[model samples]
Target chain A: MSFELMLFDNFLIEKQAVSEVLLCNKITEDYSLALSEEQALELVETRSDSLKNYGRIEFGSGIIEKVILTFADTPYISQYRYAEFLNELVEIFYYFKNETLDLISDDDLIGTMKKYFDGVCQGSLDQLKFRELERMAKNVRLGLDPDYNDLYDSEKLREAEDDDE
Target chain B: MNSVKKTTKIDVDKLSGEFYFQSLLQEAYVKGVLSPKESERVQLECLKLLADCTERFTRGKSSSVRVEIAQGIMASNLYTIGIHLKSLPDVEAALFQIENESIEKLYEYGLQVLKRKIKVASYFYNRVCKTKLKTPNQAYNITIDQGFKPFFDHYEINFHAHEIPSDIDYQLIHPVTDLAGVEFVIKYLENLYYENLFCSYFDADIIDEVMTGYDPSYQNLLDNICEQVFLNALGCQLLNAPLHPLDFSLADLDALDRQLKKYSQAELQRQLKTAAQELITNLLLTNPSLKKYLIASLPKITTTIYRGLTTHSLNKVFVPRNNPNIKPIRHYNMGIKMDDAAYREMVTEFLSCRFFEDKLAIIKEQIKTLADMEDLLIAAELKAAEAAMIFDLLEDIELAVLTKRHPLHPAIDAIDYSASEVQMQQNLNAYMRALPRDRLAKILGMTTTIEVV
Candidate 1:
């Protein structure tokens, strides 16, 4: 029997305007952070933002939480979405971390790629409920998983997530 | 001078009505609108635009000058457009109709007038005339300096030298005022559009209140400039015509003025955007350039190009009275007589000002950058080598060569004429006819108004 793979534990909502689509918030004030089940469904219907590569909404040194893009409903066993997302993240990573001026050996390039690749492995989101992300937070630069490379930590991404319960 | 000798009398009516200032508006200005080259091109365009626009002001088929007719035509044309614009469709279309009809109806015929040795003052441009006291080259420098000064000077006299360059035909054109009013009003319209756009998506009342709180001058400036452009294109000037007072201002402005100002800022801005739109809407409704400019992408590059050379970029503030963002017009003239110290002070201020310095620097940088690009383009001797050259070019800081030969390098040029007594009198006659008697009267009455106000 196979267990479902969870991409990341949390999908942090960045801005209010876009958050409405994911039922990120239910209350209709100037800002609402949590959406009711009905509101979330309504939001999902209204908005069509998918968390491809977790998106690079805000840029330049300033984001606290590293949001991840995971399946909103039931996580399926034996799927490769994490790989797809990682590929995009790696491209961004290669652009920014890139040290060698087209001269570094292939071995060194492979090592560099692997270093970031492993950092993106969150193991399983279910177990991260009470775990502190200090190690990853300190290690990863600009909201990117240590494995991913590229510009600016996200500023205000408005992507929503799976049920918190 | 060579240009003056070459200058032959021609009928304004015979000249095609389609192109205003065509003789002066060289190829550079016709396409890019306002660019770095415009410094010199403006001299040409203004001549072309004014000549085409005010053809009716000409009294004879071929006279040296007719100051009086030019004056009357400017006033009459101004009133017609300022009062009767809008229903005419667009500014360009209006300009077309007025360019043909109003000018044709008013002026019985046409004449390429000339003035010899008579004092020529360009009140419309900045206060940058260095009158005939020096050589052609030196006079050109002084006249170029006049482009930097505002036209609104208490003193309007600056003498450069006696001779003129061969490129320009007119004996001596007055210091054409910088036309900052045009730039200023365009900015006002843009602001109104931005605010109105924001409000439409946000809150209506808040926008209204904010607009209400704005300085009355903004509305006045907007109306006046639009009205002025319309009128001028119609071949007229609004020296004393009344403007409609709007809801924003308690002061009595003319009725027509009020309606134009009150029109939705964004819609109007979106509509009258193209310089061609401006020309076509006012002069030719079907001009293709009209649609091109109006529908062009955001961050209007033309506005960016000739934006008020003054004003801080990036760091902006919101203010009503002393708003530095406002386009500074050519308004300062020291007086007719300036001693050594005053002239030096004027030059110093112009150089030190942020706008002029910034513009000068930017233009210089653009020139240098273009040279670097040219080097890379030529390095195409080998594909891989060229790519390497491009990368190398980007890295090399000093390699930037100033391609000194920009289209507008010799920015200002003039041609002075040896006036015969006959030509001199003809010029004197035009001045006597169109002399700004109203301005003189107002100036005389100003001392009393100062105390009363």
Candidate 2:
């Protein structure tokens, strides 16, 4: 229970997470996206830092590999900025997990993040973070559906009027 | 070679009950009983157990949880293990189990102990409810009736076993201390059940009269009723009188004052202890635990008796019982209220009036009953000083009835109040504070006895 004893680096867990991250390269390489062993370790370290920064603790194999596999085929991500994008995605995932008060499951949250990144955000991490995920987290906290957006309904109504014209 | 025996390094008596596991580890490490390598192994196993518990906590759906939650699970895990360790024969046996067993295994043992402890707690709770003292004390009644319901219903044994989830506001004669979570609760309930069992010996009506003699307003006091009842019963035994009434006359108090004044502090404690023993014997109390519980309270009772004797207040200590059913000296009828339709029309006209003089004139001409006046006091938009004028129309008994009904609760002011009601309360408080001291005291006293019809 002591913090000093409980907060060790957990080297074995880190190594396992790194191996899981590297395993995603098999599926991700189809999209010309791949993570090297060093990049995989850094992603694991990023997951650790993000978990610490967001006051979260992960047990067993983590959601990093899940994030990588889910976001790999997206047009928004490429090998050029893939590592940095994955780091931000890992960080943002933990941040919104808390922001949503854990009401959203890991798979659902990751699936929704991918849906928005490809659909609405259109490759803009800032839009995904500041606009889409913020509203989604607020919706979850207010006990509404995570995708409930009144503005979207009004805009859809406006678009229908434009079609009628 | 010198043939000298080596003494033990750790003192078992010095270990804390609340943090037994942590202190055991610390003491074992400092005393050179547990090696650093062994300690590190225990710590590593504990962390692994925490990881397992966290996975269980999230039902394996999520990979991560908040840090505070992980910390709470870790503390709960350690406390569970400590409970098992405390069940072992002695410190060395506990240390041996800690050294040899895996933390997960120790945690399993703790879980078994906690389950048994829950049954024990429930048994004591039922006993307490059965023997609960029949008194008008709100804290005692509510604590006995409703306090442990949440704990029984929602106690999270895995993640929050170290937390006490009950509302226990009633104070025990010997407060349960140095324990946490279920152990603290079990100890408290056990002590309370013993107190209730002792009080069950006397007739419930006699106990009520004794509490009334202690304080007519004893219903609001948080003081333990059992302690005073036990002291009075002991006083009855001290005077060789019948113990059923549990009352002491003035002559009884004077005789007790003279008989007990001859002893010093230690001698007085001895006398109380002997009288308490005889009390249990005469009352036919065969429960060994009850005997110990009452005897353990002798020192405190002796101090109270000694202080009372020295201060010439033996009557306060061994009070004569009074009938709690006495009628009030003055009965003030509120009179009949006007009908709702007519009162509403009057209130509308009063609110529409622009001047304070007009409001006062309207009140004087139309307000006939105290009920209509009470409602108007809340509904009207009169200022503080203006509201005092309305209060001036009521007699002392009427004010006492109102004071009893609308006691100035600071907590209620934060929610569910109208502006006019707040103003009325402030005005009434200000006016009552400005009353003549004698008249205010009389009114306050009447509040306890008055029943407004």
Candidate 3:
């Protein structure tokens, strides 16, 4: 077999393992929406298509696991949106990885994404992806956040203001 | 020196209109040319004329431009005063009559006029001073002032015996009495064909085409002494030699000329032939199996000829602060002419050799080992060559790993090990690949790798 076919087979196996774990997580245990073999393959295909759209390729690295772990504890995350959100988050992670000059660590970027998604974005994936993360990327490019330490600080403060109101 | 007091604060704009009229009146009274009352009346009339000119020049202009125009008017008035006193019997007395404040105001304006005249004189002198003249009996005939005497003395000590040919016009050359003068001479001679010929040949036009053109094998030898002079000057700058123009003594040029004379065209050709034969022998020894390919490719080997110095060399040659023109020598590439098909065939043969595959394997192994290391800082500390090998390997690995192709056994094993490890490997690979090739080469050449911790 060609090396790419072998690698793709390995990738499919790894994706199956990750999908089984994600579907059986404690937060989604109450929901009876388990992904079938075909559904899992579709999820993998969606991931490959999203990655290609961003001009990126994965080497079976678990960016999906990290995104799941980051958003797993959110109160609004439901079984229906879980798989699709993970797919879009994977694409956004790789796209912004290049956009932020690759200076922000993966953990820091995940933390920034969770802060925007849970706080200012208030569980709206569209707002987090299009509005907050885009602005943060621009700030990073213009050297406003050299270390990215304050990437989500203002959003956190605004969340506090909204809670008080 | 008495034209302006060192401490005077002269504002160019403030020295216009009323201020200029007051200064003129003060000068008239001090010189006893007019009584105090008469001077005051004359100053009032002058102020009217000054105001009229200012209004005319500043029309439709902004405030800042108006101020600039007013300053120009004041300057014109000063120029008129200068012309009036140019041939005055007591010019020094009239100049001394101006108050310290007025003198300070006019200092820059007056100095500019003097500078322009000096520039004209220098231009003419540089052009006409090349006529042949009898050499001075004494080395110290140029009476440089006491402050400049030490620099001139050092020049004499270094280049006393080195003189240009007596047949060349002295008027064409600047007398190299100081460092700046030496630089001027070098700059002038750079464009002159005669000086270039002198650099290569002991006598001008000695090589005749009629005598040397009969033999098809004959090659002409050009003097490269001037290039050597530039190199040595660059070396001197790198060493931080205190004197300007990075002095090249006459004796050094003469010695270089003699060395060039020793290598005849025929002898140089013979040496080149011997060098080529030795190179082929060495190449065959290194790769015995590729003997046929080497033999075929040897005659067609075309190396790029670098025409000029690098940026670093140019920087050293013309230290920016001292030589602001900063004309970096132009660099160009020249290669041996070969048919495209033949060149492509040669390249294919060379790339397909077992030597390239062996090298690629070694580099790949080194990269995989470095990628496996837990601490990136330890990998960073590898020798420059090892680091360069790792860098190239990482680029190839990244391309393969990303595309899911060229699956090296070890790399595939590493991919199966853990995600974070793979991520770390990818990050390091990208970082190293992003670095400049020259930088990677330098790092690899070093004994120890750079410390990242």
Candidate 4:
């Protein structure tokens, strides 16, 4: 078989493995909610296209599975928004991979995303994206102290002062 | 009618002039035109004459002068009467007689022979220079064409030299008789030119001495010098020193040579020591980033990591490969098949990842200000060993991504860059204290050392 075809087959097998992980984790308990084979393939294509803007992707990295698992537990991401959420998360992950200078581990970054999503943003994807993640990226770029909580508190204080004035 | 039988067959075209003459004398002995003793005596005299010519050529004397000398010897009747015959046994004597009778004509013929040999050597030399020799920093002003033009011009003017000829007798006359030898000579000359061009440096008689060695097949000598030149270029680049042709000028080289000549040996040594110290200081301050990058780019470090990742046998411990929660981190025997080009490409990717990752870690955790980063860098400079360890750790972490059988590692996981941070700071403090008072003052922005009484 051709090399690309072989890689595609391997990718499908990996995606199936990821699907099993999602089911076991109770993120999608039923087959109806689980990612179908076609959905998994489409997700792979979308992730690949998203990663191109950042840098070259090594084949067989299973980046699609990693991104899927990362955002699978977001509380308010409806079944309808599942694919779109995975697409955005892949884009953000790679976009920050370049922005954060690849220093932050994928696990830590997902944890941070989870923290802001559950705590401050309260399951609002747009607020977690634009306000929290964008601010953290900006602070990193500016070479500020990386304590996200400190940055968020200071920003909150500054906004409050602006309101008071 | 009785016919006389020819006893010896000689192909005149197959032999050189000297050899053809020798063959004629042998044939004469067989034909009974001359006795064996007479032929032997004449052959011995001819050998002596050729030996004299060879010695003169080896001494760098022009072949025309040697020919004229031979003619002068013949005119003075240095050979016996029987040796003066013009055919068969007389061929040697005939050749000498022509030299004596028409010295100018013989000189002209010798010059043509020399020119023809030179023409062939030059053809091979030019081809090798154009194709095989690499002058990485060969720019317009200091190009090989310009550098070799003078050598060619010198040869053109000194066309009287018959040191190089097709005859086997003349092979010892010139250093380079064969094309391969010519190639080595051209490569040696090209390297010398590059060193002079880039380093603003030249040893006055090194090239001349190498040429005078008369060994055009000295490949080891060429390789050793070429490697030194390459290293020098790399050093200069890392120092941010001006590269060849860009910063080099003819006048600068001349001036340096003049100044070097003016210094006594002891004075030159003292000056060199001071200059070296100052150069180190200037390099540290001016090009720290490049120096650190070069240190990081050392082949010793990269090759070790690359070899380990690509070839080292894995110690496998099996776990379920797909389950993320099980943390199935195991050494697998799945080696990636790649060539040198592919390996290099992957290494670049890994390095980029590492560089950014290190920067992000510092920005996210350690750095609060630009001064903080500077302090860290200065600390690194003070404790080089610790800094190298940190660098190695970071490189390993970056390389680990490619080694893993599974890609389940989170892209945003936290990595610690403070492994040596505390110790680096301690070393930096100690180094600051140990600095000379004047040097410390300068670093502290003071014009002079403050007296502590």
Candidate 5:
């Protein structure tokens, strides 16, 4: 039962991950969003740092390529700060994966992020992270629909109450 | 013909049992048998297996897990692999399989072994239940009854193969150690089955009497009952007497003392072991495993006998039976009680009395039966000294009946008695402890054999 001595170093995984991330560029290129090799490696490094910070261990190819392809066509992202945007998005995705208690799948969580970024978040990563995604994670934890919002429900109730008054 | 003998560089005997996989890898690496590249490949494959397990754990909905969950899956995978490796004929074969096969394949093989081990564990558990001793010992009863239910119901072999899920509390003469999970349970049940089989030779009621003779409150003790029965049986064999009663009389003790005083400690152990072997044969025990189990307990039994001999307390080692069959020589019937109306009035007045002397005066005047006196003793909040004086009014037989009926258990049984009862018990116990040795022995001896109507 002892795993105390086994190192979880990602030195070998990072090279493979970097190539996978660069392969996503061929798809993102159609959307005018492309990452250089350096940018791809940085994104992989960002995934590693986020995993460590969040006390998580990812196996296999991870969700980096998935995140890149999923977020490629979003109007919020562009080539100017595409690498930086992906890095922050990767970190936020991992942080919320834990916040959601792993009940939400990788695909579902990434799709929800893309929906909020283009919709109410209006391309604001901070809004998506701090506000929309936080609410969604809370809903998932509470066994409610992932899109359930008490704020919106209360607002509607208050408007109806005022109409009756 | 040329043949190369592939010997393992690692000494299989020195590896840890609980951490078999880790220790085996460690010894292999230290001996330079497993190169750095091979070790890395194993670690990576182990991680890959963990990742695959995590996916199955989460139903492939998540790509990441908390580090603890991952580590648990990793350890379970390694334990599974270790089980398979251990099933090999020798350490060399184990090492060869580890070097040549994929960890996933080894883990699959381990799962197969684990599946078969579960059946083996089930067989042992059934044997243990069938041969379980009938006793009033709570730990022994409950452990046999309910301890392994959780293990059979919810043993998580996929992720927690190294964790024992049972709550076994009874102590065995030879405790199960250096094993985990199902292996630990199997060894424990196997030993218990043997102990039960040994104890089954004597009558259950006689065993209880012998335990009561050992300690009037031996039911609460965690000591193994079988060892005592075996020791007493061995004592009977040494005395050339019948082993059914499993009791030693005072004359038997004197006889044993004179007989064994001649042997030195080593000679005493050798004699006891030989007697144990003879005792086994007398009982017609042909099972080699049972014979071996009895012989294995000789060291502990020998130490006990040796200590008893040196201290001149062989009576304590080979205890006499408190034969419930013995008729009491004297019986004192508690007379009829006063009517409830007068008893109620007296208790109210006694509770109203401010001084201890007044309450004692009321008790001496109104109490007609031991039953009413016993009731008032509890209802009244008398101090220890007051209770002791009240206890002095009863005869030895009356006191013995009260003592037997309301035996003062130690703090271990504190939770069962009420505060008022505990106060009365402590007072009664202190009074009995202050009595002369013969008087106390006579009272206690009567308590065991006396019948109350």
Candidate 6:
């Protein structure tokens, strides 16, 4: 469909479709990209330190809790861990999308996004990060020059968009 | 082939400069036969042509004089825009600059009229000046500098004081946001109002800036902008079309042509009606709370403009699809068309059944008062509009409508003007633009009276 189809995006019932596509693409599974299920679990353990490190850098700890609930259950991980990570990750995403994204630069957003992305790749986060490109494309379709560029890796974004779609 | 290339007695006369100009329109003439990078190619040619035209045409004129002349020509682009908008096929498109591709690229006027601003978040809402004007037959001065006054007896939105543009008339009105404004532009330009183009310079790169998105390669933005410009023109065309004001359906007036061109007339109209209807439904019928934003948007003067607008009488107050008493309401607002009494009576009978079966009088009275609000205010301010405003009563009228048509669940309604008063009152105009509906509401004079009888 033409890019103007973006306006109809308001009618979309779920953004999770993008996430499902990401998981199916096996993007997060790319161990070759320096991230692996083992590393994700370790990151989760370090993040959440359920046993110790309970009270330092609460935000970072939150990030840890965030990663745990998010990356919890794959063929490599368990569902219990998945729920924790999903719960924390979504709250943070809302915080970032609703709160900090605009005041901060894409550099900071990408930096933070990269941290979350580090926890889960080739799966949901990658697809979600890449979804912004479609929004830009939609803006182009709607006759708005979305004054944001120089913000992402275009080739990776294109590849990710193709994969997500 | 070699002779044709090298020695084709290139008869410059055969060109009338038009053909060479046309050839130059390609990458070869101005770029010295370089590869056609879209911007480079188009920019180099048009600019070089513009330069050549000015330099040669201003023969023996001082460079300063040439610059001055160029500036004047560039300034004329505004006139061009006014004319272009005049031809728009629909009102919405025209107001939004629908078909005027690359309009934003045109020099951003340092002096901007009031725009309707939305709040970005809980702490900030941008103030947007929403002005609605009906198209008129002849130019009328809309005295602007005399500005607006705070007349709020009811309602919570802030009323802004504006300085009317004195250039058009001692009256501050610039002519787009009022019925007379449309007429002002039309009558002023019966003959094209040619300005001295030999005086100013046009910013040649702004269109690219406006149309270029984060993905620089996105070519469709320009196309869409163009389509919008055209749609805006279509609005003008629709309003100006010879349909008797009584016969207009707004649908019969204009249609939008955008990326999808294959849709038939009915399909396109349905699509447009759907979009326009969203605004109408929200503004007139939808509960303000059930929706994301308030319909008590920019139009501190919308109803007044509606009354002034002779066309589209049905728009006086958009009765929801279910409102049975809407038929009598239209007659109540419009009464009979004095010029075409026969046709008007015929319309009343034919359309009345579709509108309502009961309580026509009260509904009619309500809509009539609603329609008269703007007219009464404007007429009152005709003598001294700037320092004094007649909006307090109208604002109350608006509040009455909102309160009566209260859409909020009785228990969980957000405070009215929470978005505007909290954010906009703080003067965070530039911020909160993107996320306009996110402002927090100020708890000033909210109805907390739970009268549990």
Best by lDDT: 2
Q: How many residue pairs clash in each candidate?
A: 72, 0, 13, 12, 0, 82
- Give the C-alpha lDDT of model 1: 0.28
Q: List the residue pairs that clash in candidate 2.
A: none
C-alpha TM-scores of all predictions? 0.14, 0.75, 0.27, 0.26, 0.74, 0.18
The sequence of per-residue lDDT tens digits that candidate 6 reaches over residues B168-241 is 32211112332222223222221111110100011213222222321243242212222211222223333443
Candidate 5 lDDT over A89-116, as tens digits, reads 9999999999999888899999999999
Candidate 5: how close is chain B to the reference, as a TM-score? 0.70
Going through the candidates in order, what fraction of the true interface contacts does each contain?
0.00, 0.76, 0.00, 0.00, 0.78, 0.00
- Model 5 residue A10 CA deviation in Å: 3.5
| True contacts reproduced, candidate 5 | 0.78
Indicate the docking level reached by candidate 6: incorrect
Residue B356, candidate 3: Cα error in Å is: 87
Q: Which tens-of-lDDT digit does each residue in B229-287 have in candidate 4?
A: 22323323333454231122234333444444455545544543444344335434344
- How would you order the candidates by TM-score, starting with the best? 2, 5, 3, 4, 6, 1
Question: Which 10-residue span in candidate 3 chain B carries the lowest summed lDDT?
Answer: B302-311
In model 6, which runs have C-alpha deviations exceeding 4 angstroms? A1-25, A30-79, A105-107, A113-165, B1-86, B89-453
**DockQ of candidate model 5:** 0.44
Every candidate's DockQ is: 0.00, 0.37, 0.00, 0.00, 0.44, 0.01
Please identify which of the two predictions, 3 or 5, would achieve the higher DockQ against the true structure. Answer: 5
Comparing 2 and 5 by TM-score, which wins? 2
lDDT of 2 by residue, B1-453 (tens): 999754567788778898789888888888888899998888888888998998899888788999888888988898899999999978878988998899999999999999999999999999999888878899999998999998899888899989999999999999999999899989999999999998888898898898899999989999899998998998999999999998887789989988999999999998888888888889999999989898888888888999999999998888788786775345567778898899999989998887878888888899887888889988875677887877887888888888877777778875867666777777788899999999999999999888777
Question: Per-residue lDDT for B1-453 in model 1, tens only?
Answer: 555332223332332222222311222233333254443333333233334443322222211122333333333332222223222443444334433443333222111111111122333222223121121233233433443233223221111111121121111211122211222222222322222222222232322222333333433222111222222221111112211211221222233233234434454344334332334443334535323423442233223212311232201111111223433232221123334464455435434546534533433343244333332233222233322323333321121111111111122312232223223223223332343676434433332222210
lDDT tens digits, residue span B1-453, model 3: 559533322332333222232453444556564566555444443344345444444341211112233444544554444423332334344444443224333433444443443354345334323421121212111211132233234422111211111122222222233212222333333323232332222111221211122221222322222232223333233233432233433343344334333544545334334443454353233434223332332222211001112112222222222121333232221223345565455434434546545545533443233323223323234334543454454433232332232122355847474544454445445554677797645444331322221
Give the number of the best model, judged by DockQ: 5
Instruction: Name the TM-score of chain A in model 3.
Output: 0.68
Better of 1 and 2 by TM-score: 2
